[model samples]
Target chain A: MIQVEGLTKYYGALAAIRDLTFAIDRGEVIGFLGLNGAGKSTALRVLGCVLLPTSGRVTIDGFDVVRDPHEIRKRIGFLPDTPPLYTEMTVGAYLEFVARLRGVPSGRAKARTIEVEERTATRDVHDEVIGNLSHGFKQRIGIAQALVHNPKLLILDEPTSGLDPVQIVEMRQLIKGLKGEHTILLSSHILSEISQTCDRLLVIQGGEIVGQGSEQELATQMGSGGYLEIEIGGPSQGEGRAPVEKALQAVRAVAGVLSASVIREEAHVAQIKLDAPAALCPQVVRALVAADIDVMRVGRGSAQLESIFLKLTQTGGQPS
Target chain B: MSATFLIARRELGAYLRSMIGWVIIAGVLAVDGLLFNAFALGGGDKRSSEVLSLFFYFSSGTTMIASVLIAFRLLAEERQTGTINLLYSSPIRDGEIVLGKFLSALAFLAIVTLATGFMPMLVMIHGKVSYGHVAGGYFGLLLLGSATLAIGTFGSALTRSQVLAAILSACMVVAMLVAWLLGRITERPLSEVFSNLSLHGLHFQPFQAGIVHLRDVVYYLAVTYVALFAATRVLEARRWR
Candidate 1:
């Protein structure tokens, strides 16, 4: 639904985003992953038709961003990093104004406003002034304005930015609920936020696309192997780190296991960090069981994605 | 509604709902009333027409000042608050945004200018006052207000700070107001040019004296058109920035 090629934008003599090339299919939730000042907002601004790119081409559906911006504007909804809200306006009036501004018919604008308010879970504050709403409610209202016209594409810059943990989770659920209806492109610096909500990621660094794929695909491409955490019950007779270390020593001998170390030890349980590909977790578990070590629980660690992100941005990691 | 009218309506509503609007209106009325009572009424036993003309004279100053204050926030405040992005990303053209904002300011200025009608009605109490004079003077006030508001709109579009917008527009209005003074010192064709371009002296005097010259009408409209066109171009240029 969206195609961008050689999208370079410059602010004065400095380039903000250089040679950004990517395509997103219709109905896909695409995450634009980058660190702060990684040119993610600049690129999104170009696509949102808010800023004219210094060079390159961007097309939404079939209309060119430069030549047919008005047409593309009618087909897309954009939320900037800070929500563009009139603080004096009530939520309902603000949504209706945006709906009409986006070309929704006067007769249907009110109904469309309510529909999006419900979708974004902002119905309770419909009559409240935007300035009085909390940051989370304001963010939801921001999303609601984008959705009020029922556009085919939603471009949200930092949708969950500055929200508390609960608000972030609620925003994630809100975005996940929007998955099938519209092609979504959202940007964020938070790894787990993007990983949990996006079907595909376009990792950008230094104004360029360094990597693009699913989580496992990125780990595979970058050879940024993941680790696993194993919890053992009682540590095999409550000895020192020896019995726990010995149990992990057996798991290290399993194929594809790179290293192992004890992360924490307690009265009844111990957590071991196994440096191995997550795909070999089953074999490692079996190896622990063969050594008569009681494995209580096992799960993949989050450090893998963090390493992949760091390598891609900090060291120019290669993409497949 | 069309995008232009919709934007104008919202902007008008904003002015009406905010305290700044009423404050400005009240200030203009108070100052105009004070000048009317002190200078126009208290001086001597002047003719009714003379009193009416003095009323329009001081009213023009307040109107121009109010125009600068009112139009300074039209576009600059949108940029200050980041609400311009909403208008930028919308399907409306840049010209529509500029025209819509100008129309709203014009509508509000009309209300403020017309609210002083009672002052002229008081002139009719003692002596015979020409209705044509009242109509012509008001017509001039609205025209002057419209032209200055358009210039202020252009100024607002050039900056993000409302203070800077007000300063820039006030400077421009002052420059135009002083053109007649400049005409007095310069020679021949230059003097003639400055006099013709004088915002209040050469252009607005006939209307102040109960004559509605078509050239003056056309001049104010031309200024309004040029200024609004410049404001629209400024908005379009911002997309590239």
Candidate 2:
């Protein structure tokens, strides 16, 4: 549904986004992942038809952004990082206005508004003035406006920004529900949220795309073969460390194990980090049990998306 | 055109709903009334034509000032509050956005200007004032208001700060208003050009004196058109920025 090539935007001498090339297929939800100032908003704005790229080309649904912006605008609904809301208007009125603005017929605008409000779960606040709504409701109103005209693509800059945990979860569910109807490209600095929601992610840093793929693909690309973290209870006394060491060695010998290391050792338990394909986890666990190491707990490690994001952005760089 | 009217309707609705719009209307009307009573009516007995001319003179000043105040928020406030993205991302043309905003402010300013009609009617009651004079004076006021609002819309498009928009527009209007003085200092053909180009000097004097000149009407409309076109260009340029 979208294709961008060499999309560079410069605010004077500073380049906001440089050489950004990507394509999004129809019905796919793509997450733009970057830290603050990583040029995520600039890229999204270009794709949204809100800003023109300094150089390069963008097309949405076969229409050029620079040459056919009006056509593209009619097909795409963009929600900027800050929701473009008229606070003085009621939620229903605001949605209706947006619906018509995006080319929905006036006769159908109210019906479209109600449909979007229902989809975004903003039906109860239909008559409430937008200024009086809570932030969560306000964000929902933003989503409602975007969907009111039922465009082919939805570009949301940061849909979960500034929401509490519950609101974030609700928003995630809301976006997840929107998957099949429209092509969605949402940007966020929140790793877990993007991971949980998007089919694929574009990791950006310093105005450049550093990585792009599904979560497991990125993890494999980052050289960690999708790891397993295991916590085992074993003798940690003077001579007791020997059994734990033997268990670790035995687990390392499992068929798909690339490497293994003891993460930390406690008096009665030891946490081990294993570098291996996730499918080999069961074999590693069986090996540990056969060696008389008591397996306390086992799960996928934190080094999945987080480590890949950190590696791509580097540790100290802030998200743009 | 439908997009233009849709935006205009929403903007006019905003003006009607907001306290600032009412404040501007009340303030301009009160000031117009005070000037009419203290100066036009109270300076001593005079011919009704002179009184009506003085009323137009004072009302023109209020109209110009009020136009700046009304239009300063048209685009600048949208940019300030970030609501401009709705217009920018929509399928509407940039010219439509500028025209819609200018028309809404023009409509509001017209209402405020019309509210001061009682002052003219007062002159009509006590003395003899021609209906043509009243109509001519109001037509001039509307034209002057339209021109200034367009200039202010251009200024609003140039910045996100409403204060800066007001200042920029006021500066443009003041420069045009003072062109006649500039003409007075310069010599011959240049002086004629500057005086003729002055926004209120020769152009509005005919309307103030109860005569509607075609050239004056065309000049105001031209100014309105040029300013609105510039505002549209500025809106288009913002996408590049």
Which candidate number has the best TM-score? 2
Q: Which clashing pairs does model 2 show? A: A35-A319, A35-A320, A36-A319, A36-A320, A37-A320, A38-A320
Per-residue lDDT of A242 in model 2: 86
Note the residue pairs that clash in candidate 1: none
Q: lDDT per residue, candidate 2, B1-241, as tens digits? A: 9999989999999999899999999999899999998999887789999999999999999999999999999999999998999899999999999998988998999889999988999999999989999999999999999999999999999999999999999999999899999899999999999998898989999989889999999999999999999999999999998
User: B1-241, model 1: which lDDT tens digit per residue?
Assistant: 3899988988998898888899989999999999999998987799999999999999999999999999999999999988888888899899999999999999999999999999989998877888999999999999999999999999999999999999999999999999999999999899999998989999989988889999999999999999999999999888776
Question: What is the Å distance of residue A206 in model 1 from its true position?
Answer: 2.5
Q: How much TM-score does chain B earn in each model?
A: 0.98, 0.98
Span of 10 residues, lowest total lDDT, candidate 2 chain B: B36-45
Best model number under DockQ = 2
> Residue A188 deviation, candidate 1, in Å?
1.7
Candidate 2 on A259-287: residue-level lDDT in tens? 88898887888888888878777888899
CAPRI quality band, candidate 2: high
